[model samples]
Target chain A: MKRRLLLVSNSTLHGGGYLDHCQQHISSFFGKNVKRVLFVPYALHDRDGYTKTARDKFKSLGYDVDGIHEVADPVEAVRKAEGIFIGGGNTFRLLKSLYDNNVVTEIRKRVMEDGVPYMGSSAGTNVATISISTTNDMPIVFPPTFSAIGLIPFNINPHYLDSDPNSRHMGETREQRITQYHEEPNTPCVLGLREGSMLLVEGKKATLLGTTKARLFTSGKPSVEYDPGSDLSFLLTDPMRS
Target chain B: MKRRLLLVSNSTLHGGGYLDHCQQHISSFFGKNVKRVLFVPYALHDRDGYTKTARDKFKSLGYDVDGIHEVADPVEAVRKAEGIFIGGGNTFRLLKSLYDNNVVTEIRKRVMEDGVPYMGSSAGTNVATISISTTNDMPIVFPPTFSAIGLIPFNINPHYLDSDPNSRHMGETREQRITQYHEEPNTPCVLGLREGSMLLVEGKKATLLGTTKARLFTSGKPSVEYDPGSDLSFLLTDPMRS
Candidate 1:
């Protein structure tokens, strides 16, 4: 079986203190009896505050909650870990730190080459792309333009939500960003993911796990709506073989 | 002096009417006695509606607007052409027509190889990249994945406006998009253009026009603000020497 890669999002999470979509699904990839969990608190406003709770959750799950730090030795942590879970926070901040520490290269090697069951929340998932050009963050921090370990070819625009009528600051909507991507190059297939939706890439199969329709955008093609949990082998590689 | 390249924008234009930016600037490029003008109306909303008006504009300048449907035929039109202008509308629509008709190759050859004096508004300006993945429109219309002619390497986010307090939509701002670009695969600078602002590329010099400052995003570097019209020869190759 292919190692599981999971992304948990803060964008869609309601209230506080509960896992959104794909939270429990992490167990499916790493067996129910998985041990040794490393939770990254880089995104937390109160990194220390979240660390205690994360440690408790892992202890309840019968795994060790190794350590919680604003900055950790990513290479050493991954090297000694069984399963890695990166929780949600500001993507720009998390990625900037990772790039700064030179842990990005090691993390890619761990997941793509070593088959580590890698799981991330909002920003964690955003980093799984060739580049994080699609994230909804201000370029307050700059990191290198390295491709994510060849786990995926295209970029991911995560935590996608349509425009809410009740809100007030005017700017480009999530739909508009995808449109901008389409207007500029329109080649890479941009998956506009809803809150409950999760994209599962196992081996060559890319399975969408969610309850609603996810939109796919490609260059020169009309934007199409797709039901989640459907196998998208046709979109990637050879569909006929799948 | 190197041949002039002009870009006209449709975004941020209030209730588009007669040409304000195009006419005066374009007239200056070729001089008062303009002899040859080729208008690419692929970006206009109503192709037929704007095509006639564009032709009239050229005729008013005492220059003939060559070929309508043959706008894609760059080889024939670009030869000995004194001026090339692309009108504004939906860049996606314009690019779709360009890609479907397979005119990108001929145009790239004319601009990159033949060094024709090129002028484009909105969509026409957007097509000068390797891909149109950074445009500011809905992906409703399909253009080629890499529709840009790659006259420049970085992505162009045109008609960029800061968030207006009155309207409410949640997403990354243009500054955030450049930030995200800097965060990952730190390559190709992101140029966030406002209305009336244009990028002028002549031979080896790429200068930001109109705007006083441009935000420069690079990997591992803090995004710095640079004055517009600064000599950007570093970003370009010396075409004369090459």
Candidate 2:
């Protein structure tokens, strides 16, 4: 069997303080001869903190951190690595860099075709969707299009959470965002991921890892929230064969 | 042969404002004997000022207004209606009502199957997408779950505007919101609809209606801007056949 992919929430050493517990869920994966970590530059301006923390974590478990490059070299890095970890950042910036450099195509090949372990946190995980139309960011600086590697069919809105009870932003809440997504392409599911949550995909299996609940939205239906750590692998694996 | 659908902007009379220009477009359709209008309560509140304006406008135009409660009922109202006009109000609220009443499924049947002329303004227009995830409203309350009728295959963030350059929101501008959406799903095209803008979809034809420019984003690529009133029906139409 091929190794699984690992996407981290943040490239920061301490996991952006929000996803502090995410590391624990994947510790078992790391323990299983999973070596080599790649830090996406679109999210990391300085890999010093993230690289060091990741190195320490891996080293303590007898694993090695393979490559940390400032340039976009996803294909080469993932091709040789046993596992991959994509940390989070401004998803727009990260995706822009990936698209600009054509790294998305390459990464797709490595993870989906070669069966390399592909892991992503935050923005990294978000790129798996067909269109990131539900993200709560300005569309001016970034393009208003969404495309993905197709490892998964649905789009993801990572770092998703319910509205802050005290937020005065005067905008729709997280649930509202997903509903709007359904209004467009009602079939593609929108995964609203909360902090410390990780969606583990293996072949056709997807497991939600973390404390917060994951919300699922389908077209014309009300959104439903599932408990943390649910077996959502059905979403990843194609049901067509069944 | 089936009559074509006519999507009007806001039904609310603007009292001769610039937005009132849409009336010319609406009248053009009526000139062809396209009668019977289904007023979408999905976006309008009975108590709202805009709703009153829309009612008055329809009456003045000599067209009968059928609320969601009247006509053949929501289903019959959709099927028997010669035209469908989704007026503007709070799009989120309207979407909520649609989801609550299960009217989205019916509207979809009418427009996609029955070929009812579907017209909308502002919030009404926003719901024409696969999902209404792009409206510019804050999700004040979470609907049972957020999803809208997907008359079109993409997401639309209506009421798009450049920052006032003077007003201070002190955060991401409208452009940024769409950009972030691209980073996540990176597939469905996100359209920024400014005031007076409309997208006329006839069979396989999608004509852009308005004066300002709209922006587009694709995965891994830089964002691009489009001038309004362009015949970019290809964006919404099926190029393979049309």
Candidate 3:
């Protein structure tokens, strides 16, 4: 599949407006033929408000945007969409809404077979991987299964943060948590996609973008950090990636 | 049920040894009749090593500790145990192991109905509540269900931390994540048990212990912070607690 994806780590930077850092990247990814973007507001608590916000953002990019929920047939809207975008919120709730509407397979098929350019941030980026198992969000809702769109080989842990050794708190750090994951049988390779970073994929090539260094974790191997613009395409084709 | 419980928010302080801060408190909780503690080390990745460390600490406290895994029958061990201790690790893996071995109901029955003293730290503390949904750990493993021991009325968010408002990070803070939980339908009351804090439950009362303030969150109510030694027992009998 000639798939194109922009798996964003977060929607906004520390002090930037929503999608401000991503507007140019998104426009460049979609190109001229993309006159409309189908927005999945399922992750949001207030769907209407979220949709309206995303709609305005995309509209500023000179495209008409519609929330899949606003339409009677979400699957049909997905089928006819020029581009698709899934916003971030609670991953569990997002996956549950997808399963409840029976749209996971439809969205997966479209992004994989139809080769419709797809973009996701936070919870959205979580669903783009094998499963949303590494998400940092609370389990506010129960999804039918942990299965998700395997658009890429390895799992992406968006908005990843390292442990603060100086902090008085004793909670497990992100790295420690991921180490526990590797201890489990048959754990997948995980990319600790720090905030402000995004993974751009086209065809079989995936590149890590943004200024921050990202951490790559695999079992029985030492985790390594990669600088910005590193070629991460190896993850897309590694059968024993885990 | 005449249950005695000590739900510790963490196993260690910032620069302390494992369970070092709570060793005396644990000894007091178990009393002289509890000669041995059945330790559930399932939450830990290195169960054997973790049990060894915990055993050393408990041994110093003048008690024999048995790792449940070393025993032939985990359920039977819980049944015959004078006191049960669940050490902290990953909540998801711990609950999954409990459900897999059919030990949740047995342990719950023993601690809640038979009056066997029980204690849990970190992920362990998270499970001694209505559900493990409020845990701050990664979703490294999926439990068969979110159903937990239900020893307490509300859920416990162990090692809870507040938002660093001055930080440049864009990820949701602990408070925001819990608020997202409340937005979901039928959310239970969540107690943000800060590090160094714990809940001591006896008979019909539960009291907050240690130096830090614990955050209380309930739907349609402003989240409030409770100082140390606060009586939080009313939550035990509130039918509409959520």
Candidate 4:
């Protein structure tokens, strides 16, 4: 079976409701067969509130949302999940919870072997990548590792922002941070997914699906930009493995 | 011996030269006795370039700078150092090098026990605190632990920026990130040091230094602002230990 994923940059766009910008994409990605979504709300502090918001948004798209926290056995829930949706929050907290719940391997197995559909927004999209090294969120907690589910070979920097020319702040810009990521040995390519953008993957094919352009940074290479509908299947194959 | 530390928010101001905004503070903090300063340039990728910057800046202040990387033994370098300065770059890389070079404990001993004056800017200030959970830098690399030098009881969020009311970005504001850090169990208070601001510590007393005001966020407590002269010695005591 082919692995399917819809990795969203953010759950909400500026001046938009929750998942409003990507509602259509979500609907088509899950399709009619996936009746329920296993929502991982561990990234956030308030699981109930986050789950409710996700539930409402998924319900509007004709799908029921079941928060992974609500289940008696999280591993069993992931195994039985028709589809998986992870929302955005603190990346460290999300990855730590995924480890604490011992669901990282199970989720990977379900998505890779069982062909369960996987959907992630913001922090969710971060964990879907090979690692969360490119996330914009603060490291409020230390996870057991920086590794993630590896649904995609490359890392996604969700909500990637451009440097404001007028800003006087001396902190490293978003681009600078991603460039620094490449300084490490054996680092993977980083996709800077701008707000209102996402990547849709079916089998070995991946496409940029949104209104804005995404930036790609690879080691020893100049960063490039990609527009909506651009082919990104090349990112699916791990360069290290190849 | 008194634990002396100068934690700066950033190395440069909006329109100033490197360490230009806080030169006087650096001079007075080091005093006339500390003639040679050991500089830790591990936070940045270009060790030589970063060391040159630090050497020039400290020279202007009537002190000689020695890059820790230049020495054969980093731990020995830390032990014999008259003064220590860690410049800012990526926090993850900085902490990882500190552990990899086996200098975290040595630097801690040099400053906390031997009364060696410790100065850190940006990522440097981050490592002086309890943890790097509140840092704004990306996790380009994973360190063995999030634990840092416990020179201060609380954490410092250097280069802290206020949320722009006019901006459309949906990312978490600096305040929100620090608040999220408090959500973690046994977390320490966080001091958000804006650009051109720093924290100066001597013995049990810590004072807010530099031009701008600093914001303090304690768990379950309302956030408060502190001016340049405000007494922040209370933060020297670890509530977890008490």
The C-alpha RMSD in Å for every predicted model, in order, reads 9.0, 11.7, 1.2, 1.5
Which candidate's DockQ is highest? Answer: 4
Judged by DockQ cut-offs, the docking class of candidate 4 is: high
lDDT of 1 by residue, A1-242 (tens): 35457654443344424453444665576666558776776654566777777777666556677653543566688676677777665555676567666767776777766777777656667777555556655433334442343356665666677776754323346765665555554236666666666777765667877555677666556767779777765554631122
Give the Cα-based TM-score of candidate 1 against the true structure: 0.52
* CA-lDDT, candidates in order: 0.60, 0.59, 0.88, 0.92
Docking class of 1: incorrect
Native-contact recovery for every candidate?
A: 0.07, 0.04, 0.79, 0.76
**Per-residue alpha-carbon lDDT of candidate 4 for residues B59-160, written as tens digits (9 for 90 to 100):** 989999999999999998998999999999999999999999999998988888889999999999999998888889889898999999988878889998
Candidate 1 — which residues are off by over 4 angstroms? Answer: A1-242, B1-3, B8-23, B33-36, B43-46, B50-75, B87-100, B112-115, B130-133, B137-147, B153-155, B161-170, B183-186, B238-242
lDDT of 3 by residue, A1-242 (tens): 77899999999998799989878988898889989899999998999999999999988988889899999998889888889999999999899998888888888888888899999999999999998888998887778777787788778899999877667877888988888888888877999999989999998999988768899998779999999899998888882464
Summarize candidate 1's per-residue lDDT along B165-211 as a digit string, tens digits. Answer: 55323344556555544444435655656666676777666777663
- What are the candidates' individual DockQ scores? 0.07, 0.05, 0.82, 0.83
Error of 2 at B41 (Å): 14
Question: Rank order by DockQ, top first?
Answer: 4, 3, 1, 2
Model 4 scores a C-alpha lDDT of 0.92
Please give the C-alpha DockQ score of model 2: 0.05
The regions of model 3 sitting more than 4 angstroms off are B239-242
